[model samples]
Structure formats: C-alpha cells, structure tokens
Target: MHIHPLITDSESLKSLCDRLAQSDFVAVDTEFMRENSYWPELCLIQIGNREEAAAVDPKADGIDLTPLLDLMVDNEDVLKVFHAGGQDIEIVYNLTGKTPHPLFDTQIAAMALGLGEQVGYSNLVESLVGKTLDKGARFTDWARRPLDKRQIDYAIGDVTHLATLFPKMLERLRRTGRGDWLDEEMERLADPSNYENEADLAWKRVRISSRKADVLGRLKALAAWRENEAKAKNLPRGRIMKDETLADVASHPPAGQEGLARVRGLSPAWGGNDIGGRLMAALAAAKPLPADEMPGREERGPGLGKEGALVADLLKLLLKIRAREGNVAARLIAKSEELEMLAAGRREGLSILTGWRFDEFGRDALDLVEGRLAFAVKGGKLMMTRTEHSQ
Candidate 1:
C-alpha cells in the first residue's frame, strides 16, 4: 500500500494541484464538521488521480487554497469524481465561491448501473475493488489537530478507492451506452444554484402539516427569519428554533408578546426579546392569501378510486421488471410517490415522464396504466404483452 502524502503547506499543496491539473480526472472528498454551526467547517480534503493520492489539511495556518480552487475552476479538461458529492461540493463552493465542473458522481452512476439507488462510497468500493473500508474514523472530530495515521489513512482511502472506481464505472456506462444518463445526473450535481443557501427559499425545508394559507404564511415567515438568524449568527437553525416549535408557532400563532410567551419550546428570554417582537411583526405583516394562492394539502397523487390500490401494486411489479431488464435501479426509475402519480394519471412535472427515465420505463408505465399493456406468466417469467384492445 502506498502511503499517501499529507499536504499541509502552500508549496506542497500548489505542487500537488499542479500535478493533479495534468490528470484526465481527479477523485475528491472532504471531511467537515457542521453539527453546531450553520456552515460546514472544512477540516480535511482528500484528492487523488490515477497516479497519486494526498490529504490536504485545510486547517493548517498560512496554507492558501487559491491554487486548488483555481485548478478546479480552470482545468476544464480534468473531470472531478466524487461519491454522493453534494455536501463536498457545497463546502468547496462556500470556501471559494466556485463549483467544480465536468463532475462525475459514483453514487448516481451506480444507480444507472443497477448497483442500487444512492449507494454509499464504502459499499461501491467494496463491490468494485473487493476491499472493505475501515469506518472507525468516520465519526471522529475532524476539527481536532494532529490527526492519527488511522484517520489519515481512512481519509486517503476515500479518494484512492474513488480513483479506482471511476474508470470501471465509466467503462460500464460507455459499454452499456448509458453515458448520457450520467451526463444528466452530473449536470444537476455540477450546478452551483443547487448548493446556494438562499434564506427566502428556506421555508421549503420546514415541514408543516397544515396547508391552510394562514398557517403556511406564518410558517414561511418564521422559517425565513430563522434561516437568516442562523446564517448571521453562525448557529444551526435548530439552535435558533426547533422545527417542532416553529410548526407549533405557525399552527397557533400568538396574538401578542404575552401570548408568544405561552408557546411551547419558546424561551422566556426570546419571547421578551427583539426576536419575539420581530415574530409578532412578521405575523402582522402576513396578508390574507387569495383562495387560488392558498397552500394545498400535500399531493400524494390524484385520488385513486376503486382498484387504484391494485394498479399501484402492479406498477411496482412493472417497475421491478423494467429495472431488471434495463439494468437500472427501480427506485431511480420511479419512486413510490411517482408510481402513485402515474397510477392517478398525473404525468406533468413528474421525473419519470421525462428524459432518460421516460425512455427507460415511463412509456411502459403509461401503457400499463392505460390498459394498453398486459402482464403474462410465460415459463415462470412475467412477460409484458400488448393488450388485445390495443391490437
């Protein structure tokens, strides 16, 4: 096993970045702490190509990451590979205001290859490289200084296995002529807009059971306020106000400062402070929503009348068949919610109705729903046949 170098200084990091810039693709991973903070605190970054791997200590003093960030943005020829890369890319974007382009995500690729949906890096590495990763250091405090050899090795192993896994997965995609499928997935991943933490959009993250416009309006205001506070104070949103408390406050809004004090989970200090005043002002400022603009109950898909449940069950079976035949994961093709939507004849805005998904299983799903396709047991295998009515 080659011992991966630890780059802790500017000169070494620049040298490594220069070498990596020449590679066709680089596998990247990050270790960060975010349990107590609003933003992830990047502690370590592991990067590798076909030839070499290294762990860069982002916490090292006077170590500038500009060279690395520049290389990532400028080297359009070199592809960046990551497994479940959303958070890793977010950290990079937060630090440098740049998202790595021309990226490949192994977890997404695995789904396209039928390895299963949202496959973990360890599982993918084990399946592809026949090596079980040591996960003991996975939960370690990465912010602590003087990382042990075991910890370093664990970090290095992430990108090392990725370097090996990317080629094999890429080859599988090319051979199967499913490379375009990955391109779509990668495009979504590479988009910087996906990682932006816009405060106004933060309301979407809060779960509110009530669809009443008044309740939703209050919840939206409170969530947006909390998001702004958390970002400004550098604290977790839950630390500012718990989700349950936020929901409760939205459900039964306080009439005044005194009533605000009565809300559960709201601290006495906060209720009496400027935050409470702001909450009151937000509620006061909320205008009555138009009937059409009112929030509606969560759409579980159109109401399935009699026999709707049975059709949904059959759709599940069809999904499995299509997944197996197409060598792709069923969940990737259409989730249960999407299956119900298809059964209910609501195709607009559904992912299965578009792109590679449409080609893979959407057409047959529509056919099955419309009675244009039928399933038959032929030699113990379930076979799909066009219905006599269609013929």
Candidate 2:
C-alpha cells in the first residue's frame, strides 16, 4: 500500500479523503488529549484503505478539515472500520453530531472469533497480521508540535495495519458464517446514545446507593449543573466537583449559598461567589424524581442470595463451556450481571434470551435452570446432557 506524507494542508487532506471515499471501507483511528479537559482535543486523524494510508493533522495551521469530516460522517457508501473505536467515534460525534455510519469494529468482531472481549488494536494486528507493534511512542504527547518520524510512522501504522486486516477478517467471518452475529454488536458501537453526553442523564454515572426521590432529584439537578459548568469552562467534571462530594451534597444539601463554603470539596470563597449562587438555585429547583424513574432494590440485584449465587456460578461455568465450544467470547454472549439477574428469577427482558444468543447459549441456560441439562464427563471431555428433571 502507498503511504502518503503527513497531511498538513487542506488540499492533500481532501485528495486523501476523496481517494479513500472510493473504497468499500476505510480503516480509521485518532490520537487526542483529554486529561485536562472535558472535550477531547483532536491532535491527529489517521485514515486509509488497502490501497493507501495517511495521517491528517487536524491541528495544522489553517488546515480546513471540512472535506475529511464530510467523508467521515456524510459518506454513507464507504464503511468505517476501527478497532476498539469508542473514543474515536465519541470525538467524531462531538465534532459533527454524527458518528461514522455503516461502521465495523474489529475489537467487537474479535469476540465472535474467540480473540477475547475488547481486543486491543495491537493484539488484533498481531493475531491477524502476525507482527508485534512497537511500544516506544505509546504514551507520547500527541498534542506536541513537530511530531517526529517515529510518531508519524507509529500513527500511520495504526490504520495501515487495520486496512490490511479488514478484508481478511471479513473473509474469515464469511467462512465461519458468524458474520450475522456481529450486526447488532456493530450497530451498538455506532449508537448515538453511547456517546451523546446528555447532561440531564449525567447523574446516572455517579454511583450513589440512595433510591430516595428527593436525593435522586438533587443528584440529577446537580449533575446537570456540573456538566454545563464543565462544558462552559472546558474543564474535567471532577475539576469542578468530585463524585463523592457531589453525592454528599445531593444527599444533604446546604441551607443556602453561604453553606457552599462548608462543603468538603468547595473552596471557602465559593460561599460568596456566583458559582455558589448557581448551585443554590439548582438545589432549590430540585424536585422529587418520578416514581417510574426510581430504581427498585430488586432491579440489578443484591437480591441474589447464597443459593442464587450458586446457580449463577454454574451458569457462568456453562457460559465458559459454551463459549469455548463455540470459539466465541463468553462476554459476547451474556454478562455476569445478566446471569445473576437470571438466577434471581427475572427473565422477561434480556438480550441473552433473544435471537442468536438464545439459540447459542440461552436455551441451554434455561435447560440447566429447569433441570433439563447437566454437565457430564464423557471420554475425558466435559459435555452436557439432557436431564429433564425440572426442579
């Protein structure tokens, strides 16, 4: 494949994007910094197909990225391929309010091939392309100017290797006929809700155990306020207020704006500040969370006791056996929490009990639960048998 020089100008980037747009699929990757800010600062975007690969500098002086952005989001004909690309997709969505569609993720695809859950790009490359990647520049500051040859080469290798791997992986998937299993998983990777960053729903990210309507209300309101504050300042949310501190404040709100100074994570000066006033107003506006939105104790389950725990463990063993036999990742079939939920006797809604997963593992799981299946030792190999003694 031909590798282009660093795309520091708009014309080169447009040409590169236009060429890539003609391919059936393009491999994509990005290098960005976000440790100091809420938003990811896109430093470089590397994109390519089997014919060519190039690294485009989004931060280059006066370089217009409109053509590349349009290719990334607007070009529906070309599929975008990435390995573990959640963050990359998030950055694109933040920039254009749309993720690259007709997307394919190798990391998720690796699960179906028994490469383990959430396979790293390096691992995927090594497994598919038979080469070990260099790690010297893995942690280099991507935002720095005048990136050396090593950095640029490292960045370019990401997509070049991916471009080579895409067709091979596709061919293998076609051979195994497990290609259909990846449709839902790939769709989920490109789902907008995964990267929406909805301020109103930010409270769900904070792990507070309280189910009280009033406390939850405060948490929801305060989380939204903090999200807006962080976005306005372009600072990390924790830079404004930590999760524990935010939860504490929500559970036990101060009497007035002056009380802000006494809060554990707040500065004494906050009592007299406009920020304090805004926080106070947010708290004042807090109303009880609606009944429908309140989480029940039985929902995610601490409700699974010793007996249910045993059942869940057996189900996990079954999952491992099935995953190994099928040469697929256990996590791709069902999560541990879902096993616990199933063991706890809640089965009305679960992905495991539907479609291909149900056909692959869930049916046997139900059989085991109802005493219709049992593990048996046969010719030094562990196997399952029908017991059909529903208990």
Top of the candidates by lDDT: 2
* Candidate 2 off by > 4 Å: 378-381
Candidate 1's TM-score reads 0.93
Q: Estimate every model's Cα lDDT from 0 to 1.
A: 0.85, 0.91
**What are the models' TM-scores?**
0.93, 0.96
In terms of lDDT, the poorest run of 10 residues in model 2 is: 295-304
Per TM-score, the best of the predicted structures is 2
Q: Candidate 1 at residue 131, lDDT?
A: 92
Give me the overall lDDT of model 1.
Answer: 0.85
The alpha-carbon deviation from the true structure for residue 384 of candidate 2, after best TM-score superposition, in angstroms, is 1.7
Model 1 steric clash pairs: none
Worst 10 residues of 1 by lDDT: 293-302
Candidate 1: misplaced stretches above 4 Å? 1-4, 289-300
